[model samples]
Target: MSITARLLRYFAFFWILFLCAGTIYQYINFKHDTYFIHLKQTAVATGWYLPAFYCHIFGSSIILLAGFFQFSKTVYNNRPLHKALGKLYVFGVLFFAAPGAYVMTLFINRGGFVFASFFIQNTLWVIFTLSAFLLVKNGKIDAHVKMMHRSYALAFGAVMLRFYIWLFMRLGIGVDFENNYIIISFLSWVPNLILVELINRYNKCPYRTLQN
Candidate 1:
């Protein structure tokens, strides 16, 4: 790895670990506290909050770490671990995270605009993930890798969403809660995709071709 690639790898590793820690904290809160806030809301509305929340929290957290390692050429060269993690990542997203996201999208506040944004994000997330899986199944390794990068970028929205929320609150750019959420809903994953594009364009890394 070049100096820049090494630095990027370290940054990605620690950033993902940080997100995993945050997610695990949420899991602990739900597991121990019964997620009383959500339970109360669910009592008022049949949202199935616990299942959906747990699915997204756990599934996404697990996938963040799994997917981070996936970018390492070392791991990708190790066929057994690479394939194992790839299957786990796909299964987690397909069965748990994406489904949970779609279900939870029904409960987003601030009305239709926010709902549409999240709905689109969740839908594309699933589509990209499925494409990645299908590409790999058909032996299109380069395409599969590109698609997986795209899918994982969207998945990282959980972290980027929180960051945007915090940053905007600090700056008082859009302090209105509903409006803030509205911005972050689309803001979260869009920058991630753009970043992925820029990295692919500039880095010109062999394994990082954008053949679609």
Candidate 2:
């Protein structure tokens, strides 16, 4: 790797580590604190909340950080490790995180718009993951890469949500909390997809846009 590429890679590595560390800390804090911090009273009323919450939090944190190492060329060349990580990622999302998100969506902060944004985000997250898995199974490496890139972008939404919240707080920009969250619901993932699109275009992957 060139110097600039190495620098960018290190930056991305640390950034992902930061997000993963924050996620772990938040989950650990939630475990000891007792009640739901972000959920509405209605969601808390549901007995399924904690189980689903843990599933998404723990599973997503693993999936998010797993991507950082999985993308390494060295790891990719190591068939066993690559395959193992891929299976773990698929299991975490399909069986735990994605289902948890689907259930949790029913209880998001009030307003149809907020719910819908999150609904789409989680739905796409699952779809992208499955698509990546299926593509790789069929030996479509390029298509799989395209799909996985999209999946990671959505997975990173959890991290982006917190960043935006902190950014707003640091700016001392006061807005209705509910409205702000609703905006963040969409903002976190949409820009990520747009960014991936720009990368796909410039990088000129073997299968640009994953078209056959």
Candidate 3:
């Protein structure tokens, strides 16, 4: 593998480890946490928040685990297993994960443009994930792959959210982390989508854009 690819693989591995572990731990703790419970109780948005919250915790944990497998040379070549897991991944996002994310985004305590920006991104994540699924169903191979990659990038934003927050604190800009999150919200997936485009460009693959 090229040096860049090797470094990216290492980065992906560490991110999966860090975020997956944190998500699993936080979720298990959330099951008994009065803080989360109280937030659910006092918040008017529990209807979607609770489900989305758990979905994020559990679904993301599952995705982060499954993500490693998706890139595996063994599984990637095994179409049946790949398709099966991909279906599960997509289902988790469409019905459980992405929808829940949208709900939670609505209840973000940091009300303002940050909320608006996140909500917008959350909505796009849903659309992107669903569009990917439908493209696959319609037998649009290239589009399906591109859209799915975009969806996963948005899903991976959950990890980047934490990454930027930590970066902010390390830089002693803790108070401005909210602003940092807003920037990350847009940037996290945008670059991923752009990378997908670059990949397609390099491979000379034809894809159907959302405009199409």
Q: Considering summed lDDT, which 10 consecutive residues are worst modelled in model 1?
A: 203-212
Steric clashes per prediction:
0, 0, 1
**lDDT per residue, candidate 2, 58-152, as tens digits?**
88889877876777877777778878888999999999999989888877755898899889999898899999998887878877888888998
Error of 3 at 90 (Å): 0.8
Query: Model 3's lDDT to the true fold?
Result: 0.70
Per-residue lDDT of model 3, residues 67-175, tens digit only: 5576565786677887788788877777777677777776767657677766766677778778977877777867776776677777777776777777778888773
lDDT of each: 0.79, 0.79, 0.70
Q: Return the clash pairs for model 1, or none.
A: none
Q: Considering TM-score, which of the candidate structures 1 and 2 is the better prediction for this target?
A: 2
Q: Which residue runs does candidate 2 get wrong by more than 4 Å?
A: 1-12, 26-41, 174-178, 206-212
Give the lowest summed-lDDT range of ten residues in model 3. Answer: 203-212
TM-score, predicted candidate 2 vs. hidden true structure: 0.85
- The candidate maximizing TM-score is 2
